[model samples]
Target chain A: MTETQGLHIAVVGATGAVGQQMISTLEQRNLPIKKIIFLSSARSAGTKLTFKGEEIEVQEAKPESFEGIDIALFSAGGSVSKELAPEAVKRGAIVVDNTSAFRMDENVPLVVPEVNEADLKQHNGIIANPNCSTIQMVVALEPIRETYGLSKIVVSTYQAVSGAGAAAINELKEQARDLLDDKEIEPKILPVKGDEKHYQIAFNVIPQIDKFQDNGYTFEEMKMINETKKIMHMNDLPVAATCVRLPVVTGHSESVYIEVEKEGVSAHQIKDLMKTAPGVVLEDEPKQQIYPTPASSVGKNDVFVGRIRKDLDEDRGFHLWVVSDNLLKGAAWNSVQIAESLLKLGLVTVK
Target chain B: MTETQGLHIAVVGATGAVGQQMISTLEQRNLPIKKIIFLSSARSAGTKLTFKGEEIEVQEAKPESFEGIDIALFSAGGSVSKELAPEAVKRGAIVVDNTSAFRMDENVPLVVPEVNEADLKQHNGIIANPNCSTIQMVVALEPIRETYGLSKIVVSTYQAVSGAGAAAINELKEQARDLLDDKEIEPKILPVKGDEKHYQIAFNVIPQIDKFQDNGYTFEEMKMINETKKIMHMNDLPVAATCVRLPVVTGHSESVYIEVEKEGVSAHQIKDLMKTAPGVVLEDEPKQQIYPTPASSVGKNDVFVGRIRKDLDEDRGFHLWVVSDNLLKGAAWNSVQIAESLLKLGLVTVK
Candidate 1:
């Protein structure tokens, strides 16, 4: 391919929720894609999805599927990414992986374009996407961290069921219907699909997300804790997360309490920073009763932040309510943004 | 009335949600009640509610309604309590008010029986029940505070709509039904009914609980912060809260992080502390996928404590998940337990 030609792209797990979003985001974004292919597991193979009004048939993902593909986005599952991400990398395709398989790998660069676009230069053909909860949070906090160094972060997430996947979404809807009908609900896919003990996600909040780690923090919480440190390039930064799944379908909301290194930073100053911050929309107007809710944040690409206030006791501490479409800014849009960043920063050349 | 005979009891706002639970809790508890009267606003005065299998008509609460009453439990709105509580006190009745009106009054004791039962003895005539979210967290944390002094607390709540009122609960049910039917929902009561804007709470979470205070903290958040300090008698303790309303009907769950004054404390030690803590149930077996969820905590009087773990970075900091029925342990049962404490301590006289 010449330098003037559009890059060839492939979307793994194209039939899944974030995969479909990747395709749609790629179609909407100004990324130069010469050709696009959709791939999934054998189970989901033969599925048809639309891209820019064109129906694309999903084929079973294999090593050869990466041939002639310049960029590939993987979101099927961790096992699928672990099995095929290297194959795509071997075929000269840069893979933006949306699983936890290689996030902590020393060689991989976990990129949230707005936060660490420069880190894309360190990618070894495979770029890792941070956890959905971690991506939006870093996007909101990066500007603050740059303006005034960040000291500590404690976040409690009100996450959506969609993060668990399409089956989990279906379970949530079905359970809601059954619950409203006053019928018995047998939860099959929630908290974690592969883990034991599925809890009802309709009309209830489950404190467990992903599987519990030996340290009592769930894998999801650990991801948020670890990913933030890595993506922000601050390994010693104190970060803690309590990830809980809410009944919401799309957006993930976070109640973030942060301590900045600088003293006497007013909430108004932080609000001003968020207003001019990249990819962050300031929705904080308490008197007007205007704040971002998960329902209002659906299908949005930008992270919504509001409820910015200084901690009552600690002058260096501040509280913010950050929200974004979990499937978009958290997953698909983030991966696609990485691809766009690669092109924008000349990290990947077409020639 | 004599001490040998049962004491006269009156329940104000008997037609409301917490009032109804108060009646039921009174029936089940060992508190001696020789006479019981139900009272409400004039509009709900004639509503008939069953207590101890006997139908009691709610009368319009007036100064004369508390005549000869020894103990009066009030769950009416703040305005009603401010207007009638002193009247009840004048008639020789001690008031356990489940409203925000008297909670911050320095002269009135804000009692969470598990944490501050002894404070009941200091009540001049009116006692205040703590906010639903505050009551549950303090119950789970008081043991730790007693064992190792607490220095700081930060809590993010997954609160139920029932904390708003019976109308908010109905709104949640109706919105769920409407949303399940793919119908549009216009939320009228949620976050706060008196608040200007109403957001959908069916599949959504509202970060603002009550009205937003001038300091950018919601009234509910302020109540949790202030009331926790008052109940624990830690006037200078640093407490912060982000109170969010969930779609759940009854139970309120909190993600609480606290820093104890003493160091070298392990999560296991805290878990052990919770196992025997008064009004706290330890469900911290992560391997068994057992934790306190809003669904599992329904109808229970105790605060369900689990996911108790030390912060990964802060040696003095520990995290906990606490859940309890907002109507039972959070409001009605707490008020009744305070009355029982008053009786047990002989703070109230039947002579």
Candidate 2:
């Protein structure tokens, strides 16, 4: 690709939920793409998607698919990313993997552009996107951490079914319809899709997001705990998360309690800092009843912050309500943003 | 009334959500009610409800209505309780008020039967029921607090719509139907119905519950904070809460993080303690996927506790998942239990 002709961009799992979002985000963003390749598994390979007002046919993903690709956005399962990300990297493509395959890898950089874009410089051809829940939270917390210096975080998430995948979203809708119609539903997806017992998500909350680990915390909770520290480069920061899946379809909301290093910092100072923070929108207005809700934050790229309050007793603690479109800022937009960061940082050059 | 005969019980606001539950709970319990009188506001009066196979007509609640009542349960709003509870007390009736009107009153004992039943002895003919969310949480925590001693509590609630009243429940269902039918809905009763703006609770989560106080905490949150401290009888216990309304119809779930005074207490020990704790049911089994969900906890009188886990960083900190039917254990059942406590304590004797 010539410098003026833009770069070759390939989207893996293009027919999937986050994959489709990646295509749309790429179309909407100012990413320079001369060629767009949509790749999916054999089952979804023949599907067609619209991007930039043009229909693009998805092809079966293969090692040769990345030969001429400058950047590959992967949203398939971890196994697919684990198998293909290395191949894409070897083929001269800088991959922004949106899976857990390499998120905690010592060699890979878990990038949330607003929080740790500088860490992208250490990426070894593959940049891992943080979990959707973690992405919105870190984006909202980064400014506070920078201004006040962070020490501890306790988060309880009200996550959407879309984060589980397109199938889980379908299950939520189907179960809801069945429940409304007074029919029985066999829940096959949610909390953990492949877990032994599937629980209904319609009008209910599941405390477990992913499978439980040996330590009793779900994998999703560990991801938030481990990824937040990794992305912020704070190895000793105390973080605890209770990851829960709600009946919502897209956006994720979190009630975060953070203890700052400074003792006298007020909630107003934190709100003021978040007002101009990168990719952050402040929507807190109690009397006017203005605050971020999942329905209101859908399709938005910015993380919405509201309900900021100082802890009633803890001098150093403050509470926040953070919301964002999980598919956008949490997944697709963050992946696309990482691609933009790669271009801005000159980590990837046009072939 | 004869000495062998049961006492006369009155249920104020009997046509409302919690009031209806109170009538049902009174019927289910072994409380000796020689006569059942259902009372509501003029708007809902004259409605007929069945109790123990007999239809009881709801009458307009007035000060004279409590003249023959030996025990009166009040769950109408705070204003109604403020107006009628004193009248009931003056009429020689023990008022088990389920509103916030007298909960913080110095003279009225705020009692969660399992947590602070002894405080009922200090009641000046009026006993206040703790907030629904606070009632369930305190029940689950009281056992642990008694065994391990609690120092601080941080809770995030996933509350049901019924806590707002029957109108909010109707709004949730209608909004769900409208959303499923691809129609627009005007939200009029959620996240504080009387507040300036309303939000869609169907397929969404609202961060605020009750009106925002001057100190920035929502009244529902402050209720949890203050009531927990008051019911637990720990004046200086640092408690914080973020109460949110979800689409669930009946059950309220809470994610509670607590620091115990004693160190090295495992989560298993806490779960063991809760197993035999009165009005507390332990449902934690990570390997078996056994945990208390709102849907499963609906219509149940017990506060279900699950997902008990020790904090990874703080040996003294533990996280618990507590769920209960907001109307049952949170309101009606707690009020009924207080009446039972009154009978058992010989505070209310047959005349």
Candidate 3:
């Protein structure tokens, strides 16, 4: 390929919540792209989106949409990814999927670039992006695991409504206004829209996030438990999660407790290590009341961590609070980061 | 005592949030109260309140306020209780303190009526009501501990702003309105009122709940830890907590993970036990989307437990989601229940 002719990239689901963030994040990144195309479902195909000050009309995503694409990013729900991602791969484009369709597949590599970039070398034409909650947690824990060797994880999430997508964000705002005016609120989307029931997410917290699995754990909880082991290459590690939805519109916060394998590590030592950890910003200052919050972490790509404390009884136990923009680091930014890794590692070349 | 006469009850901090709930809970109960008096700080003195269809004027609380009181319920600040509680006891009043003043005292018994009503029999004078967050969690866990010996507890709380008092609730309302209008908000009284800083609790969850202790745990976290062991009479029970404050107005929700001493106990057995547990409501139907949320648990006195699931890997580990109105089961309702227990146990007599 000539220097002037770079990669031909396509973004599916270009009009959705995380898809919009993908467009903007790609604009801010320095990826060498000769041509960029926007693709979506038949319903959202005709929408116009501005990328890097140029208006691009979205076309309907079909098998032919990936004809000349060198790299394709897919976020158009699990079913869409399940159908279209293989087509894109067959058409010679490396697929970076933002859904859970292929995350646990034996052939596909589940990747958080900070934790497992090398896994890309073994991907069978498709690389899987983890769930939003799992992505941010792995970013914070990877450093600790590398330094101290991790054994177990127990997490409780304070997730945002925007994780459900654009409609859930609108629902939170509308319901909050109605609640403030003392009007009756009718919730249409939240805590799983396709599920049998919908609950108010304005001033309330919902414990269920996705559909419940046969084992009584929500799919969101299982994703965190399974994907953490896959990304960290620790299949025997014990992981537990309680995923919940909060009223926030953008970022997700997690209260994580972990037991390290090595002993005699102090909380201050872990704090000092996190000060320079990749893709993580340490915002801990208890006396000054500085900590990571969902509102404070919106619109950024870094995972913010704070409140690092050692358990009073267990010598190897530590607690951490992690927050990140669910759309950015959890989805779009991570997908783009994987593409950048492909380019840097010479795994995929410009067309 | 004559059959027509009952016990004399005095309510301190009658104008505050929990104090008002205490008065209403008393009115709804059959506690055999001959006379009820409202007492508050000098600032709230002379405020008119209603009890049993009659108006009562709030009086300034002093040592003499408990002269003829048979039972005194204190929800005022810790300092007020510290100064006046012993005086009340000297005048033959059994005090149920809702503050953190005497909860850890060796001589004072911390009581959660559903879990440890018999502990009231050994109270010297003051019976300490545990923290609001702690009270609701213990109520849901005590039945499990009774059937299967308990060993460990790891909890992450989603607490309400009302736990910080009325000013914090107004702060949440005002900040939420300001955020919705796209206006800058000045946070004055959330996370911690007397702490050096205040955070916006409108659409955000704050990791810190109270003043930071030397061990890096917030005072709220320490209360949940220390009080759980004391109330359950298992001083060495390994209890770990991360208490976070959410935007809800009334209910406090918790994601609790526990490991019982017994093995091979299925999640179904625990659900069946919770169905008949005292002061508990089991709302754990995943198919119908029936579960306890902070919004649904508002104004209810019982601790709502749902999302009970056995650990996929650990045989003895299980998780539960517990919620209740922070003001009711957490503070006011628990205090009145303790007063009733005192009468039933013959620990105190009608004057």
Q: Write the per-residue lDDT of candidate 1 for residues B1-351, one digit (tens) a residue.
A: 112578899999898999989988988887877789999999999888887777778899999999999999999999999999999999899999999998999999999877888888788999999989989989888988999999999999999988888899899999988988899888888877887889999999898888988999989999999999999999999999998989999899999999999989999899899889999889989998999899998988988988899999999999999999999999999999998898889897655
State which candidate has the highest DockQ. Answer: 1
lDDT of 3 by residue, B230-326 (tens): 9999999999999999988889999999999999999999999999999999999987778899899887889999999998778999999999999
Could you give candidate 1's per-residue lDDT for residues A301-344 as a string of tens digits?
99999999999999999999999999999999999999888988
TM-score of each: 0.98, 0.98, 0.98
Which residue pairs in model 1 clash with each other? Answer: none
Ranking by DockQ: 1, 2, 3
Backbone Cα, N, C clashes tallied per candidate: 0, 0, 0
Error of 3 at A190 (Å): 1.2
lDDT of 2 by residue, B37-146 (tens): 99999998889999898888899999999998999999899899989888988998999999999889888899988888889889898899989999999988988889
Full-model lDDT, candidate 3: 0.93
Chain B TM-score for candidate 2:
0.98
**Candidate 1: which stretches are off by over 4 Å?**
A1-4, B1-4
Best model per lDDT: 3
